[model samples]
Target: MEKTKDKRREKISVATEIDRLEERRARCQDNLERAEFRSRKEKLSEKERQELIDEMAIMNERVQQLDNELKMLRGENRRNMLLSVALLAISALFYYLFYFEEDL
Candidate 1:
């Protein structure tokens, strides 16, 4: 059904967003590593080191937000699938009780 297809599309879109955020998180981690290395090798000022740490913390927060969003979307998709199954079963029960009763 169109509704099921729409749900699938939405789930796929959410998964895609999660993947993008994961990739960005990986990049952020790489940057953080580089920044730490520079701070040790080149003797960054305290302010410069703190700035890098703050930036990494912000990136980590964004990654955590994406994880939470992914969890919520997955839960929604599961709920929709359960609802579709229940509806199908109820429709079948109705068909058997009413539509097929005349043939009996």
Candidate 2:
């Protein structure tokens, strides 16, 4: 029972973490879009333009990092699900062999 509870908690935490990261990625995308629009719509000093470019680069890097992390988390979640299914199957087989086969 305790192990089940722990597993449930871990699954929930991973899901929530994924949600948080997705929200951050969305916000970063929005910021990048706004920055692009601003760069196109307004004329700015060279230094300011350079700063905007640098900021955009940083945002892009962060987005890439977030993408990688999200991918890893999703893969881990998939593996966990597969492992759970396998374990359940094994348990069922054991129960059947012990309980039902003996009566036959």
Q: TM-score of predicted model 2?
A: 0.81
Instruction: Candidate 1: list runs displaced more than 4 Å.
Output: 1-43
lDDT of 2: 0.91
RMSD of each: 6.9, 6.2
- How far is 40's C-alpha from truth in model 2 (Å)? 0.8
User: In model 2, how many backbone clashes occur?
Assistant: 0
| Residue 33 accuracy (lDDT) in model 2 | 90
Give the alpha carbon lDDT tens digit for every residue of 42-84 in model 2: 9989999999999999999999999998998898878988999
Model 1, 1-104: lDDT tens digits are 99997787666655575566567767866776776677678866889888877877786777677677667867776787799899999999998999889888
The TM-score values for the models, in the order shown, are 0.57, 0.81
Highest lDDT: which candidate? 2
